[model samples]
Target: MENYPKSINASSLNDWYNSEKEDPVLIDVREHSELEIACFPKEFLHIPISKVTSTYVEELFAGLFEREIVVACHAGIRSYNFCQWSLDNNIVSEIWNLEEGIDGWSRYIDPSIPRY
Candidate 1:
């Protein structure tokens, strides 16, 4: 928990997604209702932060060890908490929290996504 998780802004994330050979795991940790309002254009693993149990972590770990992960929420708060919980629970060593979250994305990457 001492070592902070990496944070990626919408602009940087867009650049990385565009240039990187393999895509990172884009995770939308926002609730179902929140997603109905807006979401990332890219396909993502939509596991709400409330539902991320140990079983879910094990499943993610089993298959996603090789891929980078970026977690997002409405405004970056929940995603940050998720990142810290992941590290504190020893889920993964490298995980990123999307800074400012999808609100940032709506502002920077895709204006089409309506902000709540």
Candidate 2:
């Protein structure tokens, strides 16, 4: 199985998501209110960072072990921590972090996504 990269830039991430292949799952860890300021693709899984727990993990994500996963947040910090935690806990073998988060996506890929 191919290992996920530690991080991926907004441009590369855009391309990856748009490709015809089986794309990675984009998990937005930002809180619900953050969506009012900026948003990502509709396909992204909405799992707020604050609510991530063992029960949540087992219930929602256990089936995704073999799938490519990418976590994102406002500025990448929370997602980075989550990715590390996932790895440590054996939740998933590998997960990619959005290097600059949705903020980077606004600056690099889509300017329409308002930055807050």
Candidate 3:
């Protein structure tokens, strides 16, 4: 892919999500057990990284257009990798990795979100 993809920190993402006319789709790629400790307050789709398959992705994104997808994980590494994978497969026009992941959100955006 020609594009290197992009990333958004918790602060910028929070602001963009609230100020923008269109809401970006926040997806948590962390394992289910990790969510029990802390979770993003906003509405998001939970899709474990392990279960991500071409078929599942096609079905999940079916009928969706011009969607802004933001992938998140524990510390951002996994999410960043996912972003690369998305781009490699040409899954979406735009995909952003949640830099520092939920841990960043907990540290920078909301302290209420427990950090493991």
Give per-model TM-scores. 0.93, 0.90, 0.93
Instruction: Point out where model 2 deviates above 4 Å.
Output: 1-5
* Clashing residue pairs in candidate 3 (N, C-alpha, C atoms within 3 angstroms): none
Error of 3 at 62 (Å): 1.9
- C-alpha lDDT values of all predictions: 0.88, 0.86, 0.87
Per-residue lDDT of model 1, residues 24-66, tens digit only: 8998889999999998898898989879897787787688888
What's the CA error at residue 112 for candidate 2, in Å?
Answer: 0.4
Give the winner by lDDT.
1
Q: Which tens-of-lDDT digit does each residue in 20-109 have in candidate 3?
A: 468888889999999999999999989899999878876786655477888899999999888888777777767889999999999999
Q: Superpose all Cα atoms of candidate 3 onto the true structure and report the RMSD in Å to 1 decimal.
A: 1.2
Model 1: pairs clashing at backbone N, Cα or C within 3 Å: none
The regions of model 3 sitting more than 4 angstroms off are: none
State the number of backbone clashes in model 1.
0
In terms of TM-score, how similar is model 1 to the real structure? 0.93
